[model samples]
Target: MSPLKPAFFELAVRADARWDRFSRGVRRRMGLARPLRILPYRGYGTAERVLIQARVLEDRFVKPSHLRRSLVGSAIASYKRYATVEIPGARVAVHWGDKRWEGTTDDEGFLELWVAPPPGVRPGWNVVELELLEPEPQGVPIVSAQVLVAGPQAELGIISDIDDTVIVTGVTNPLKRAWALFLTEHRTRLPFEGVDAFYSALREGHGGLADNPIFYVSSSPWNLYEHLDEFLALHRIPNGPLLLRDWGLSRHGFAPGGGHGHKLEKIRGVLGTLETLPFILIGDSGQEDAEHYRTIVREYPGRVRCVYIRNVPSRAQRAVELERLAQEVREAGSQLVVVDDTVSAARHAAQAGWIRWQEVPRVQEHQQEDADARTVLDALGRKGS
Candidate 1:
């Protein structure tokens, strides 16, 4: 790691203090409050350009023992951190919650606002666009992250997939897939071996690294969320928004192209909602994730930082298509990562410096998640008994 330049670090420290003072002054004037301590990960995740998160505060909850009359409690709560930037003299309008909130940036180029979020709004991703005065301004982007109201920390966001990438099922086989889903409905789905610990490492942020927002987007239908949730829980996987394909019922049957289209639409929706914060995408080669991700890279350009693809056995024709798609993905500015298995993928991910080496703890821990998964598989053996 490179040593920080003393001069630059000093400047950063001073600037941070000034920003806080400015925020404090604005909050005082507005009759609101700012956080005294900046607690980490209870708030947001740090990506390449943006740090995004939800609102959380610390509180305590009690747990009861079934056999005993005693109750045990743990301290836990979440906070919501919402701060705004305003250009006082220079007029600016922010579009949020279907209505435009008007404000201007002050002399120090700061804005303060009190936002009451609308109902049904999930806490994962949101955008705040600045409605500028002029039509064609040179080189100034007009969007910022829509964050929480009072929290001093942030959580990192992770967007991933299922089917051959995280699990071993092929989504293309509708009947077989349905049957398999039925058999393993609430049981653990097959993890791609080391994925569980990789996920755990990301959540725990092994070293001084920050935690992130984790999402799962799949071509799977909305009907499968319960089962998918069960699978994740069984594997001890953490949670975020599970974006699913909503293939509406039709008299004849479900549309063939609906899943692909729904997946693309979900990707776009996720992008739009998370316009401020970028994310990492993980999927497999069994289907069109590469091609779809290539298109997303083209559309969003630099928003996509890294892509992890698990290479399943691809048909020759599909192999040719994936090769072409991989090239296109490279051209769009993100790298196309291909891995043989989850262990090798984690090794490559660490090698590429995407994830840290210390995250795995021990290679055997990876084997343990696999071993646990195998135990689940065996427990299912006597299902018909």
Candidate 2:
């Protein structure tokens, strides 16, 4: 399919407005009036401009039952208990520094405003305040979301995928992945071995103070933002802005590609905005990441320093396709490495002078420990059987 155009999104916004009006009419007929709420997800941008986005929803409380230990139970609880009642055609104001931007929520009860940051705003973890101005003054019901601005001192930008690349979400397997997502809590879920060390080394760069900006682009929906954010912090992964998609139905129809278009658009926007900084593209081989990264490498030429694909067992059949993409990436003046583990990728980065070589053993040790733990678990399972 062709890339999504600005007009396409505008049309979607209009459709959402119509649906919101219809839904409100039905609510009125049913004599139901719920309080309005604004749910803003974290966003990222540069010093020049920042993107602030939020969803305006009616307040709907669903009390939780006792937390479950199984993955399926947890997943069901999260989906059923956590509330999302989008309020379409709602107006909200976004304030960052001294500047303000006003925007109305679309059919999905989502509002996104791109506003220029103040001239002297520095990089690293800046907050943008949001307020609801429509549907009878709901007060500041939402907390401010953070926007990470890449500063001039940043050596290179790192755009990484979140699923199997960082955390083991088993994206290649529907059943196992579902179990992990719903059954396990964020704090309990484990990241790939040595991912933290590898990313930390990349963030520090050659001089150990590059403060290189890292942007996490994920196919996961915005509803899971808090869960993923907690996972990142728990694993001590390098912090940055998260680019996530909106779930649920859209105006046009069912999104056939399962958000590949949305992922591509967000990645392209980030690449275009941070034109000066070359990026290290990191993702897993389980999905179309290799395809997307190859397209990015070819599209932007030397702007991409390297493409790292974490090899997964399920995608072993795609080796040929990955090889072809590697050649394409090389021809485009960038390198592509299909690594079996995070340590391999870290070693490559160390050799390239992107990180210190001394850190390689630390990453390897972490990987080995994870392998040992898994082996022990497998042995115990066999014995139990």
Candidate 3:
């Protein structure tokens, strides 16, 4: 914890970034790297201005659509994600309506462009076009990222975690988590029963006509962005922005501050961007989620309507800690709800009038149907063992 240690770590990180940038340039110039491609992430923003994020990288990773089902295949694809070949210092431009903004990718090959939205832009989802200006490709690859803009009628926003909150990752056990993450396809994983229905009901909102947007903030690396998006769609979960972390080491140290610091920072970004719209923060008790939510509640005051913590297997001390957070958040004028399953969350939302009571039956039905599916998923995980 010495000051010198932190200074030394910062120097190491900077050195690593510089080396990576240099080697990547060499690979590209020598025709050793794969074709440079643009990967644009779905972003969330307000009507006045929108925040867009994209990355430039060598397109060497195997496509999820073309991947075969095998431990080796999955492992290879996962390796490609982590062993990223970023194209740093690429000039980029974003266009919205008649407005245009220019930027250059940072040391991590990430570009964050803030551009004004087209005047009189409708809510819901909108698109912004982007293209590489420097280090141009053969055909000038242009891509679009989906930006979720809540309409005036939108009263609330939902920010949920990914790992155990949305899907089964066995995040508490490092081995099992790796098996689930690196050795299985998106279809092979199991979501909590009734999760889709529950989230859909929440998306329906209190007579909002499906305008309430959902933002998924996860510690999962951006390399898995496509797989995660596919999983969400495969499960019929409502789609929105996928806010994932960069796995590479940076100023925040290894793995982009891992779980706690990253999630809170992203949550703050969403709140700050949306301004007036309140939020419902969703995560699981598998880690320090409740603790993080408690901090968010205190920092934001009454801005958070509630914090939903899905119950995951944890040490007894963790349970006691969550119970304490429940009371702490309550005193902050928001509830830190601990739900055992998706059904529990749906029932609570129904009684709280966030969702209609009639939606309860559908959620229950999905829970029962998904019950058997859980066994098959567990078996798949065991096979990896």
Candidate 4:
């Protein structure tokens, strides 16, 4: 069939009707169909023409490259989009309904597929995705969207932690940290079950970005800033501003009590910078996230919307401290919620109307599951176990 008309795949994005109009015009003019594209050439062909197959290459590793370059408007700006997901000896199949779209990746896993809606695809809430057929398991959440006929302009922000949050390397040891990152890309993260869904729900904005901001804050060193994007993308974690620690190595000199205080300072700076906007904070009980939130609540009072603390380790004294902090949070105006895992946090956020939840696979933790949740609580109380 001839190319599918742009109008056929035109779906409204929240809070961007005018921009959407312009976008649709551009898509029509440029014949941009699918926003979803892949890279890394598994099957061999000429540099330009590679076969689009449906299989995951285990030996094949996908790396980032500037292959598909295009220009926009008058500026001859180069497109520097890179593909990081490497499939060894594998290929992906982009299927819509029963129809299949054709494309393939070069050595860099770059697939030059037409960006068009599939045939027989209807309007409103359709599964637009590319499935990794070669790999094991028939169906997985590659990517999907709820296409709407009309929508509004929307923004998204992500609030998260630093150590053991997105990055597996806790602020403990350098060698262990390097091992964690090297073995598992950020995507290989073992986030609390259902976190992927929670993030997706926010990214999709079931409503609009006004309801969410794709911003994230962590107590990690600022040095890891460059790796965050790849890490988040690998794990399919949503994208957002990563609030990192500037103290300790580069610019900010290390203080007496390590960079813990430095991290809190960064969090405070983020709060002040985003003072005018309402936000949500997701963190672990590992560092001073809760304490920082307490400060934020005390300072801004009604500015913060919700606070979710991932239960970790602390003493009885710290537990008492948290209780006091919780009281402060409540008084300042936001809710202080504690959950065992990230998945639970997402649910609580949904139930509490703090955030809209999305569907994701459950993550099973064999080791942490056996550990005592209260052991950390004891540490919080200062009564060392």
Local lDDT at 373 for model 2: 62
* Best candidate, TM-score: 3
As for model 1, its CA RMSD to the true structure in angstroms is 18.1
Give the Cα lDDT of each candidate: 0.54, 0.79, 0.83, 0.47
Lowest-lDDT window of 10 residues in candidate 1?
A: 73-82
Candidate 2 lDDT tens digits, 33-86: 576767667777788877787777766542333355565666665674244767
TM-score of 1: 0.56
**CA RMSD for every model?**
18.1, 3.6, 2.1, 18.2
Runs in model 2 with CA error above 4 Å? 1-17, 25-33, 60-73, 81-83, 139-142, 256-259, 368-385
TM-score (all chains, Cα) for each model: 0.56, 0.86, 0.93, 0.48
Candidate 4 displacement at residue 205 in angstroms: 4.7
Model 3, stretches more than 4 Å misplaced?
A: 5-10, 208-210, 256-259, 377-385
lDDT of 4 at 21: 39
Instruction: Name the regions of candidate 4 deviating beyond 4 angstroms.
Output: 1-157, 170-178, 181-189, 204-211, 247-252, 255-257, 273-275, 314-317, 357-385
Model 1 agreement with the true structure over 223-339: per-residue lDDT tens digits: 455457657777677655566553332222343453365567767865765566555678888777887777788998888877778788767787677677778888889877876
Better of 2 and 4 by lDDT: 2
* Per-residue accuracy of model 4 over 1-385 as CA lDDT, tens digit each: 1244332323221122344335545654787622322322111111122122222222222233233132231012111111122232235566656666644433323333433444433322344356655434243446432222111233323456756654445545568554553333443334444455566665555343443445556554333444565566655766554544432212222322444555556556545544444567777666677887777667776677777776765555666766777888898888788777666765665665545543322222322431333345436547743
User: Residue 248: error of model 3 in Å?
Assistant: 2.9
Residue clash pairs of candidate 3: none
